[model samples]
Target: MIIEGNDPTVEPSFTLSNRLARQLWNWVWLFLFRPSPRPMHAWRAFLLRAFGASVGTDVHVYPAVRIWAPWHLEIGNNVGIADGVTLYNMNRLRIGDYAVISQGAHLCGGSHDYNAANFQLIAEPITVENHAWICAEAFISHGVTLPAGAVVAARSVVNKTLQASWTVYAGVPARPIGKRTQHEH
Candidate 1:
């Protein structure tokens, strides 16, 4: 077999201790956090804080939500992460106060640089501003930012920034559908 130029077994950029801690936390997440009842949001938040996540007050992360690398996560007050939501935060991921990540929504902060022969990992920060809503099953790609009060419709895929505040976005690439009025809750 021909030898490849790049080493496939090369370790990721993170420190060994960080990786080990995350692996151990996975067990704690599954056993302690996942099986807990809905009212245990505070307890789960406490556990997340113990793992180095900066979680604000009254943030409700449902039992089925999956968070990769909790240390990279920063959530503000009153944020709600519904069931089946996935936060794949290989880089910094910030959710502002009053943000809602609905059921099955995915906030992905990492991707592969396909141009590299080794398929190198690329990471970027994801930000959801205050009062933004990510609807059910929506996918927010790396480096994407949702402005304050912006709304992403169900099953939408957002690959770019939703710049306008109080706007509604939908569709595969997530185009701005309409503006949300202040009076409309």
Candidate 2:
């Protein structure tokens, strides 16, 4: 069997200026924001907004939530991101109104292109629509969109877009398991 070799000459995915800004912001996020107490949601939101995130009112972002690039993040009103949730948004990541991302859940927006010899970095946007709920420890892959009122069960891995609203999805690759009835909030 022949083995593939990685190319050394591929260009970097981000510009030098962008890298510098990101590194600086990352340092700020680590020491200043990450260690803040749980009730300091407004402080965290302030920091994220300072770094270019379009955050809406009443957004609850726990201290342990890690955002790769705040400049690419857009959070809508009343969204709840629990502790240890990772928003790995190399590209744009939009969380709509009333969306809930549970503890330890990961919304990953970046991946490497396996077809490329150098394993070139590829990024896509992830959109969690209004009223969607991503359960604890769920993994949402790059480019996946969770529709309005969609529910991802605990520890589920979602790779594709869940188009139907008010549905519950679970398991590896996340298939729809049941319908969620609409309720008064």
Per-model TM values vs. the true structure: 0.92, 0.92
Identify the runs in model 1 with alpha carbons over 4 angstroms from their true place.
1-6, 9-14, 183-185
**lDDT values for all models:** 0.89, 0.90
Candidate 1, pairs of clashing residues: none
Clash counts for the predictions, in order: 0, 0
> Residues 13-121, candidate 2, lDDT per residue (tens digit)?
6777778888988899889898998899999999999999999999999988999889999999999999999999988999999999999999999887877867777
Per-residue lDDT of 1-185 in model 1, one digit per residue for the tens?
11234444674556568678888889999899999998899999998998889999989999899998888899999999999999999889999999999999999998877787776667899999999999999999999989999999999999988889999999999999999875323
Q: How much is the lDDT of residue 22 in candidate 2?
A: 85
Judging by lDDT against the true structure, name the best candidate: 2
